[model samples]
Target: MPQWSDYTNGQRIKILRGREITQPQLAERCGLSVVTIQKAEQDKVLSLTTLLRIAGALGVDTSVILGQQAPRRAMSMDDRAMLRELSRAVHDSWVGLLPRTVAAPSADELRAAVDACWARYWEGHYAEAGAIVAPLLEAATAHRHEQPHDRQATAWGLISDAHRLAAYVANLMGARDLAYAAIGHAQEAAESAADNMRHALVTSGRAWVYLRDSRLKAALDLAEKSAVDIEPRFSRATPGELVAYGSHVNFAAVVAARLEKKERAKEFLSQSHAAGARLGEEIAAHGTRWGPVSATTQAVGVNVGLGRIGKALALADDIKDVSALSPAAQNRYSMDLALAQAHARQWDASLDTLEETLTKAPEWSRHQVLPGVIVEKVGRASTARLRRVSKLLGVSNPVTGGFDTATEKSAL
Candidate 1:
């Protein structure tokens, strides 16, 4: 209900600009005339350039200015198929609808399988990841129930992770309700297992769900609290502890940046960087990764959302290598980097970054809002290049900041 999607574009801009910044102030920030700002607020047709300027000035995604993104993206066919099966597995497994005839795998085998699925997901092979987890959800659930009451903790934790994996994939594909349901089940299982590490992990996972759902305050609160609860005493902290703590604070920084609490986001970023420094390199654990690379990459995003474009670009420049990050993380960094580049008026560089993001992860890019935004800001774009990029991203009209899902389907 607090989201901006229900409002007209003009109203959304005014609201995002808020009471603190008047039209003149916004105009100054956007480097446009006050008349231009006034006309925009009057609901006149917004050129892609004007809209992109205002959206950047307001520190929001372009889609958020026009309205939220379309209720759903055009999902890849393979992803849709996998989601169908994933949805069935999530629902059936949650309601105690275990397949009676299925042979259950060992707890260790199932645990490794869930981790493998997550690895596939991070590699951006989403459908393949979903294929592994779709049936694994049911199997994990069935196996947990088969264990003796006193011996079920391991199985319970496995079920929680399996469900969490399902939620991660589903959430990215725009299956919000399914993601919520899967996460609900994941939390319940984690609680039942009484695993401290999993409790924090699930909490972080749920916070991510809240962020995608636009539950901004909830996401911030959950992430901050979970981070505090798991904060490591530097002298004695282990690698896993450091990873979880760093990931939590890094997410807290993300939410804070999005909420425009620039100073608080800065503090969290410092902590995240320190945690990463302690680890010296990326540590993959608990379905996530954290380290110097993770912290620095996320810091660029935080700076971008806070509208510190120069700072974002500076941080990005220092990140000489990103191969340590996951494929998904790399694409996401390219998104933030592109936005920073666009805001800095390095239009060519921005477009090139956008090209890299989409070419490297076309299917993964489908669900993102940033590509379309980047296209709108490319002032020097060639018609043929724009047409190709738009088709690749399925953005029929960047002026309105919405994708045509049908068009997206055909572009493939």
Candidate 2:
């Protein structure tokens, strides 16, 4: 077993560095002087209260510092290199510090900084984005810590966006738990701000996460509730262009489909479509991370739930390769295809599609979006028919059913 003392000072420092926080910074955040933090780092003996405070400051758990578990190691050389670049960018951006007497930066400036981060990140310049926004995030953290009332709500709201974006990138990079934790922090800040749009988005994002995890009922409940406060809580968007509200409706459609509530699914999908149309023109004019309300992917699922095999197939054909979507979306599309193929009695095609969906990525499993789930449903039905055919053919061993044996375990 790896013990706490097994870690060297260098290792601890590396962990601290990777966390993007400094000991002195933690001290400042915890209302302790720098010298006290220096002693703790040098002695590797942090008080429980100090550890808790530092952990909170770093958006981590206390076990992280107590060495209860080894810290998250860097991934590839690419990940390490990227982290270094990001750290450097953060440091360089903070090179100038106006006097403590100077007024803190304005919320609009921080919001602009967040926007710049997204532009660079979307362009695939991870380091540059990291550099541009790292200091801004740090400064915001410091401001909230030192001067709690200075634009407190706005500061937390913007900080939530920064963390949420980071979580998005992290999920793309395959650090799932870390991504979840980042989103959790973002939600906490958003709630602290009491900003409805941000709050709705955070809940909508979690519903998406739950959908990926195959918790359909949980996803449905959260998504529906999220959209309830759309008009009353936040006037951030027009009544029709409430993008987050549209997303909730879409998620509800997905859950309804998964639960085999064909009528409910169709109703929700139509509502989503209407909401999307209302909101679409105001948005980027192009779709966002959430697919269009009338997305063929969602339509495919609705068709499958309704047992309209031909309709499902028609919708599936219209969908482009949906692999670029998030795992939840991809799984929704793949499962629809699998179910449709099974309904059409295209056994080979159904098995092939299901296998293909499962093999795309490992997150497909951890996140519980396995296409094999629908396969199992079809497999049982096929087995009974095979047994009937075998009796008529007088064959003890019949290979009529083409279903993979593993599908038997995935029955709905």
Candidate 3:
């Protein structure tokens, strides 16, 4: 049997709570949403306030929640360095004064840089993405000031996108404060741009922030309202406008799922899918990957969140190949598939899928809590595979004896 020290922070919480306390019960006690509790137990991005609430709900000291009382493995040097760089980039974007008299990159050059940053982000090269965005944000900000009025609009759009990219990366890293700062900057730039589509895009980013913070209903409302506000007449909508509207609708569907509004979620998802079909091809507009494949991939997670395990698996099957999607999106969809499979008691199949996903995107897998959650569900049957995955992800294997139930509830 593995010792308590073998478990991750999330696993420890699960162990302490025992099977008697389901996630929904724990969430209710903590005044948090079920998704928030699930994320916390998976050791995903969670705020300090959330940690404190969990500790309180479980009647445990905060050190238990932080895993400070237990001897545990430390994060790798590479991961530590990446986090430091991410924090620095977020800080710089919020505080560093813009330089005056800076020669600006041509519009084409700036566009190329933004394009590269988005590519890196989608590829799950978050640290590399961070390295590019700081300079891109500075240059765009400086250019907005230096360029003539006619060019200023273009520069503002660039600045808004750069900040939005920063927020997206920071949010993925679980840095909520940094993500908030970046979103604020994005919104400011969007206002200056005076483009309705740009404002709608920033609103979508803000909705993501709310979702991450466990404000499910708020996130859903914001996403639904923004999608409605920016709903372009499909017959005449530009590619960018279509992408923005579709992305917002997609996010709203996920939020609705978390809220357990099944019918509403389905309605939003159908709308998003229709938008994607109209586009016909995957479009990465302002870093939102909106298209048929992307919409379908998102639907898998939505189904998982809605507790439709069989439905989620069916959706996963529909996505014949995810190679065309961004690396980040591919991994996300894979996680959803694995979660659904595990819930259905297809242990071997779940392990196989997870192994393939981790191999394809090791770095991205490290930050995700789903793998850990799945391992916990499979218990002793998954020991060998779990160890390999733990070594690959540089995290501890979840202990199997924590939950009394044969099958743990889905944590999607």
Candidate 4:
């Protein structure tokens, strides 16, 4: 019945660890030194990466260790269901269980369906998008086998897109293995299509999977190489080519920032910005949203990843219209902004930003670790307003100790 705010991070770690996990065991599981675990449990400072690892090893969301919420599975029921369906689809494709003679949708219809799936995904309707992708994959796979050579190529491209969408959803939900498999499906489809752009796009998808799994160097290398492979002569580049190249460069910047390669990260961001300027408007290509606005938004996160918090804030100020971004991108940018505010000790503003973002995209926020990270940073200082924010995020207040079980539900 105790309130979440009643405990410090150290206390929460101890409680979560309990008698089941020893310091050495946790350290081994989290790939940290025993001393690090001890220090963290003593309320000493730990890097965000280290904290995230510990949370992952403990099989709980970061919010549990941050004392913002109880231990819980990271994925929602919908996410788990989607992962299951995707897994089954991938397995069926591998085993040749997909219907061999289903009526294939027209090329235009297939293209429209894929486009709709991407739109739904970017809009934060992840589960709905996923539902559309499963059937599309089956249909595309059938078409790839049934159509004549000329038409089959198009079917392969659509199949690649469907699997790419699957990979995107799986990665976002933290199902790494499932994402890896989905990407494999996409790569196979891309190869069958014999399209350089499709292959480059799948490479970009693989880079993202690597990034999600903490293979930072691999991600950077692949993203950079893929960008270069698809880099059209800017003067002659089609808008689609511009978006493809810019998206890879944007991802490369992200990975570089994570690796602490500040100059390299900036160079990538600049390249992306140049491509965006040429494109002259927001565009979606190969399931990625890219443009000047997208580059600027990514730059904010790269700066933050490089510990250039002030620069990140400055870049954020230039984004005068959050509405210009898709819901997913806007949520991500807001998270970066909230983190910067927290690092600057502007806790009130951070909470406000976080509250608004979570309200706007509750389900998406539930899958993210940054919200919990910001909450932990702000919790270092006790305030009545902070308690209110905690309650809003479904964490109990310390002063009151407990809430009626029936009344204590997460706003998300």
Rank ordering of all candidates by lDDT, starting from the highest: 1, 4, 3, 2
TM-score of 4: 0.77
Output the worst ten-in-a-row residue range by lDDT, candidate 2. Answer: 403-412
Q: lDDT of candidate 1 vs native? A: 0.80
Scored against the true structure, residue 176 in model 2 reaches a CA lDDT of 53
Q: After best superposition, candidate 3 residue 231: deviation in angstroms?
A: 1.3
**Candidate 4 overall lDDT versus native:** 0.78
**Candidate 2 segments whose C-alpha is farther than 4 A from its true place:** 1-150, 169-176, 231-240, 280-282, 285-296, 301-309, 316-412
**lDDT values of the candidates?**
0.80, 0.56, 0.76, 0.78
lDDT, residue 324, model 3: 68
* TM value for model 3: 0.75
Candidate 2, residues 145-227, lDDT tens digits: the string is 54568557877787677666655555444445645766676788898898877887777666666655556788778777776
**Residue-wise C-alpha lDDT for candidate 1, range 147-235, written one tens digit per residue:** 99999989989999998898888887778788899899999999889898888888888888888777888988998888888898987
TM-score order, best first, reads 1, 4, 3, 2
In angstroms, give how far residue 177 of model 3 lies from its true place: 0.7
TM-score of each: 0.78, 0.51, 0.75, 0.77
Q: Judging by TM-score against the true structure, name the best candidate.
A: 1
As a whole number from 0 to 100, the lDDT of residue 72 in candidate 3 is 19
In candidate 3, stretches whose alpha carbon ends up further than 4 angstroms from where it belongs are 1-96, 99-103, 148-151, 380-384, 400-412
Assess the local accuracy of residue 360 in candidate 2 as a C-alpha lDDT between 0 and 100. 56
Q: Model 1: how far is 44 from its true place, Å? A: 41
